[model samples]
Target: MSYELQALIGPAELVAVAAAEVPAARPRLLAQGLALIPATPEFLAAFRVGDEATAAPAAAVSPSGTAASAGFDWFPGGLERRLAAWSKAGPIACVEADYFGGTGTQRAAVWADGRLDLGPITSAELEPFPPEGSPISRALRRLGARVTEGDDAVRDEFDAVGLGAHRATVSWVSAG
Candidate 1:
């Protein structure tokens, strides 16, 4: 099954905390890391398409599965972590999280310090919005980051197990 989460935070400082806190729990809890994506929109988009040629394949998933030929799983939480930091520097149009797998798919989008117009979203009618003054929403704004919706990366690693995105965690090491 797929799993996704998104949040927005502000005032800068807390971004680091969220980065360390959110992703750290997941991969460590599952004992499996996820594929890493760069913070830039272009890179993020290329990652979705499994277009390593254009994007930085820093810690990319292998074609086979989560187990890199070298035996390491790239952490998926990096994107979230990066956004947490990036947003602190400027006003981001949006923040998002996404996951797509054979069993299911998940996506989240968020906006902080501004109102979100749900009319344009893909599943806007079916989507849920955080109420104003809600603790979570407030906390995120205070932290300088907010979670939001987005789409899942393309399924590249067909041999992956469990969640599809997990497959992108796979890597292959070259031996000299």
Candidate 2:
């Protein structure tokens, strides 16, 4: 009944997250301003450009003209980033991820299908990135989600990385 967390390091095209370890610190990643999938290595690398994401929220890669033209909202309240990040590791979106019986814990494998089929990588070198922030909280606020209720904080921590805390109360399935 233990769940480990991990973060995929790659781009939307293809992603390979870091090794799954006993998650230590969970930092919320914001990608609204950036408009890129937070799951990709490129995006994570972009975030690596600086460690500010550790101190605050981090913006995801900005959606290109194509993704925008495709009617994709750059900031699906951070849903895109969350989806990409979770999918890379092969799990269901926590938001979409279900909690059974409304109590206890559940063990299962889940896979996520990120929304919006964005587009090819652009050479438009993302703007000079900035300090990071809590993308999860921001997205939650944007979506007007009641994250404060129940195990929302645990889910938020898990979304920041790839696994929820040990005390997340709610049940979560593994995306094996």
Clashes of each: 23, 23
Kindly list the per-residue Cα lDDT of model 1 for residues 5-62, writing each as its tens digit: 3323233233344334443211211101211221233333422344443233424533
Model 2 C-alpha lDDT per residue in residues 12-119, reported as the tens digit of each score: 222223222112212232222111122322333433334443223222343343232222222222333444555553333222111333322211112245443322
Q: Which run of 10 residues does model 2 get worst, by summed lDDT? A: 29-38
Q: Deviation in angstroms for 166 in model 2? A: 12
Worst 10 residues of 1 by lDDT: 25-34
Q: Which candidate is the best by TM-score?
A: 1
- RMSD (Cα, Å) of candidate 1? 17.4
